[model samples]
Target: MSKGQITKARILHQAAELFNQQGYAGSSMSDVMDVTGLKKGGIYNHFKTKDELSLAAFDYAIATLAQHHRAVLRQHHHAADRLLGIMAVFSSFIDHPPVAGGCPLMNTAIEADDAHPALKARAQQAMTNLRKLLCHIVDTGIAKGELQPAVDSDVFATILISTIEGAIMISKLYDDPVHLERAIAHLTDYIDEYLRI
Candidate 1:
């Protein structure tokens, strides 16, 4: 990457971490500067507005997450394993994220309520994409005979998405990661019972 590109990338990545950890309100631009070693003009050069940076930061989070998950899923050929691997997004390993930044989607969603429409929309789109991915996975399982033919793929997808977001929300609110375990257990059970046909 060019020097400018690398610097912009660093700013966005660190901004995501700051936003995830301290939230939009709590995380000042100075925090991002501290983390990224970028000056005011350096940041504003890349992101014209805080809202723009916020959106880019969220996309950075999802891009990182998607890259990690795609690598993990590629290790397993079976649809079941791939599906469970996706569920592994909730495992205890995620509790203490290597990034040490919480889930950006959940953080953005909670923090942007009625405050930043652009960020809120981005977060919602991320959730919708996740739901669509789960539905697609379920469809693949069905085609591969891993899931029952009678299954309501849409409902299954909705529940999985609901459970995941709910768990993350509660976990963040309660300052407990155990809620993620509870949510993952439920999602795993659903897959085992209905998708393991």
Candidate 2:
């Protein structure tokens, strides 16, 4: 990477953390400057506006999450195992998160819903991709005879994603990890009792 590329990445990295932790509205240009140790001109040189920086930061955050999930998914060969691995990734967030604040998808979706169109759209696409990934895993499991043939991949994917995301939300809201733990336990039961062939 060139010097400019490295600098831009550093800015994005710091900006992603700040935005995820403090939120778009709550975080300011000074916060970015403070994190990146860059002056206003230096920051604006890379990003024309805060909105531009926010969109890029969100993409960076989502990409970070995708990378982590991909790594976790690679560890299991069985379809059911892969699904459980994915669940484990989310469950791990209860104690250790890839990023500081928690799930960027949930955070951005909630904060950007009515305010920022571009950020909201990015979050929506990230979620759509997540759903597709889960569906693909379910379909692969069915093909391998690891999952019930009658199962609807999309429906299963939706249920799993919704359950985990809701669990994360409630856990964060109450500052309790047990909610996430119980949710993952129930998900595991559902998979073993209902989805497994």
**Winner by lDDT:** 2
User: Which window of ten consecutive residues has the lowest lDDT sum in model 2?
Assistant: 92-101
lDDT of each: 0.78, 0.91
Count: clashes, candidate 1 = 0
* Residue range 69-140, candidate 2, lDDT tens digits: 899787888888889999998887768877778888888999999899888899989999999999999999
TM-score of 1: 0.89
lDDT tens digits, residues 5-50, model 1?
9989888778888888888778788888898887888899899988
Return the top candidate by TM-score.
2
**Cα RMSD, model 2:** 1.1
Q: What is the lDDT of residue 113 in candidate 1?
A: 87
TM-score of each: 0.89, 0.96
RMSD of each predicted structure: 2.0, 1.1
Q: Which pairs clash inside model 2?
A: none
